[model samples]
Target chain A: MKNLLFFIFIHVSLFAHGVATGDQGYIQQINGINFVPFMYLGAKHMVTGYDHILFLVGVIFFLYRLRDIGIYVTLFAIGHSSTLIFGVFADIHINAYIIDAIIGLSVVYKALDNLGAYQQWFGMQPNTKITTLIFGLFHGFGLATKIIEFDMDPNGLLTNLIAFNVGVEIGQLLALSAILILISYWRKQPSFITYSYSTNIVLMILGFMLTGNQLIGYFNS
Target chain B: MFNAQQPTEKDLPTSAQLLKSTIIAILVTIILLVMVILPAEYGTDPTGVGKLLGLKEMGDIKMSLLEESQNELSQENNTSSIDSDSLDKAMVNNTINNDVVEITIEPGKAIEIKLEIKSGSLVQYEWKTIKGGLNYNLHGDGYKGSQKFISYKKGRMVQSDSGELQAEFDGYHGWFWRNREEFSVTVILQTSGDYIQIKQML
Candidate 1:
């Protein structure tokens, strides 16, 4: 429980300042380095990003093998990165709020899937891989909006965005390490099976918390 | 729920060890909450500037860039070639600046606000009234014809805290209001045909 509280405090602390999702204004162009600051900011944002963490929590909740976790995460990485790169480059803009709300919904979807809600209710399973790939696209586009928002310089945008994407991958690795460690250990304890349901329930609560906040901010604005 | 073996009794930590871990986690949580609720120490800090947190990204980060560069640069320049495109994207986004609230001291539209506030205030801080009810511009295109945030103050600010004094002020239609501080403020023009106005006091 303490560990859980500790993890949440870190997340809540980062988001309390500004919205947690990535966007342009989050990066400031200091000293005319232009996209460099954004690239650096992207690295930082991903390391501490809670929404990304939440999605990750759902993604890796059931995996027991490192290789399996890697495969799933890679799929997600490809999904978002492809969209993040192409979406901004193509100038396909969507309402950030709505996109974010959907991103929140993605979290909800994953948590529900973890709890086997889809099977109990839907009878037929949705294509998990396809859904992950699709949601990854939404997440990437979401960050791309922020990158686009930053008024990223074209001169080195490709380089910097690539750097940012790399940084995101790095951050994801680090975040996943901690999460995997926790989940792996929890699976050992006798209580692991008993608490799995509640853990995902907490994940659902966290997802709803995120969606609720974004919706309110969307409407208020 | 099968994975690597957890530290069992044979390899388990002592009773004191488990107790120590539990205590440490609790202590750490308390310390973090304090850091969050309290203000940062006086120093040049970039609460205004966010910390770059995304470090562990995909491998061969630079290689990916090289590959994409050729594909994209030849595909035609990216859409975000100009500052104007950014403004257009801003128009479609309808989220408040969840950072800090504001109250404009002027009587014109505020396009973008850049404010660096002193921290240590509750997330419940507000803009006191100085006149009639405060009115604000949500976000709109500025004279620059960009969808930059253009907001006027609206309604009044009410501060709810344990003991901090929440001053009441008469607000006009030109203030940005938020409780969280240590941020930059940007307001877009509320009306057309008028330039952004600035007052002596903010």
Candidate 2:
């Protein structure tokens, strides 16, 4: 059982930031408009995106009310959508590694905020909503840069992109619902108070791993 | 409408404690990155621990695959540029016709037939194995030992195939057939196209 779990962990880590090889081949070979496949790809991207999921988990860690969670998640959605649509259309190119590192830093920032480190170290709270929105933009750029790497055929480009964006939103909703369910169940347990702090620490470590990984990629590339 | 309690200020950690936790997180991250991630993802084993762990081989394979894929992408771009040049030149009279060749391959051996074709040139080809099926790769390589390669198609246990191939760049475009069966196989190739030369590449 331990070996199986270790094998799973290694497999997941290897694919953490990559499109599956078969899907990558499909993307390269296809020509013209492919709405459904692109949309599916978008959804798959979000469902497997560890960095985005980590940041979202950190954002909602402290929120207890559903209304507050909704508001925060919406802000994040809008922030990412704007950049994803505009960045691709405008052909705004950013180095993927740099943007992904920033995304990792966003995760780290949220984990620290959840730990109340900012309040203790700096004696002030950074406006959480604005920061979420800003980081959301960076996350969107990460997605956009990856798509740009495909050099996709321009036929039906706009419609395909829109479909992909819609798929991302749907994927976000599904992921959020699953996370909310898990968190709500965990909160009811007596261990919640004891384990919450440790969880954030783990999250911070993951953020650092992501950052380090991307920085290494940047230099290697 | 779940209402979980948020920790108040008094329940939060003190400044020194927060600092300590942050430092610990950083330290753990650094150790993992240096000892595991670097060697497993990029084959960069600075601390030598990854080599001992047998992860350096995995990293090496990943890096080489990445390099190969990047080379394929560059080759595509190079061919596309050559395609435009071919269009501008309008080589309508350059088409060659009915170039036929046959080669015998022993069991567990491979052979290649390459055509010197420019980007945008079109060719029609048909090949058949007389005996057992053979594995084949339709691929191209860049001009003058540029080392750029792109695979157009590949198959296993193929007895025959026929299709049109448009050159992506100025390169040697060809078929590689490997007879994997226990018996020898004879491949009869018929090609007619806009190409300068055709030869067996050993």
Candidate 3:
């Protein structure tokens, strides 16, 4: 598990700023109703998107109820989907590195929230649900920023975007399921209480690392 | 099953501890950025660790490759726009005529074929050796003095060639094929174009 976390940290930090070149090329060249291909691209992205997965893991780490999980996840989906569609169609552009840095912050926020850092340090508890939703919007815009850089063909843009969104949701569900199983089992272990703080601390560290990397990228770029 | 209560003191860290952790996280992030991220992402290796690990080169290659692809895409876009313009003009008063010619060349022999064409005329052509490969050159000479030759393309040890060609000047434009094989080879040339005549020049 330590090795895996280390691997993910290295992988995510290394290729954090951009999409794969071949995918970018395909997105740029293809025209007219490439629904299936676009959907596949979207699904592939979400599955491989470590930042999104990390944030999701943190968000659901403490939630024990399926209903609460569903509510939060749904809120996140709605938030991200709105901006993804709007940002692309309305031609709203944001610097990818800056948005990615904010996405990094989202992970840190959730980790800190899980650790009860707000209550401990500030003596106040912020609304986790609303915060999740807001960060979800930022996540969507993060994806939008990358997609817009592809300069995708405008033909069938709406259809392709919708299909892509569906694929993203599917990918998210798949990732969430795997994470749920692992955490559920971990919660059964006696070391859960002892290691939970350490895990959150690591998550926070990863968040800081991601943020720092992207900020460096932004300034250089 | 949701835990509704806010965190108790036991569930949280002290303010000083939290601050300490934050500072450590920041320091660690800076270290990673300097030793790993800089070299791996921007090929800017201050600590030389990235270069030692070859991560700096990896980043450099990625950056260069991306720039090259962007350059290629822009070039493709420019060419496609030009092609659309040419296609529009090509639709006006265009004439296409097809011709099939079979010529046999003896071993170590050569031949040239020319099509009388005006500048800016489009020709689609294909030529193949029935048995073996040959060296071929597609070229044109301007009708007037001082423009002796312009080469369009050339291939060696080629069995077949086919493509569209646009004449850049009023000239006799076509291909020269040389059979370097031991046996005589028959070349079948098929052409469809705006050319007026085909002349075989030995």
TM-scores vs. true structure, each candidate = 0.49, 0.56, 0.51
Clashing pairs in 3: none
Local accuracy of candidate 1 as per-residue lDDT tens digits, B91-177: 464232333333333332212232211121111223333333222212122222222332322222223211121112111112333
Candidate RMSDs in order: 18.8, 14.6, 17.4
Evaluating just chain A, the predictions reach TM-scores of 0.82, 0.87, 0.89
- Model 1 is docked with a DockQ of 0.03
Candidate 3 lDDT over A2-54, as tens digits, reads 99967754433222112233455335333456665566557668978999999
Higher-DockQ candidate of 1 and 2: 2
DockQ of each: 0.03, 0.04, 0.03
- Number of clashing residue pairs in every model? 61, 0, 0
RMSD of 3: 17.4
| Weakest lDDT window of 10 consecutive positions for candidate 3 chain A | A11-20
Off by over 4 Å in 1: A1-39, B1-202
Model 2, span A97-212: residue lDDT tens = 99999999998899888888877888887888899899989998988887787556576788878877887886787677667656765665668778888888899999999999
Model 3 TM = 0.51
What CAPRI-style quality would you assign to candidate 3? incorrect
Model 1 agreement with the true structure over A46-115: per-residue lDDT tens digits: 7667888899889888776567678889999999899989988998888788788888888888888877
| Residue pairs whose backbone atoms clash in candidate 2 | none
Q: lDDT value for candidate 2?
A: 0.73
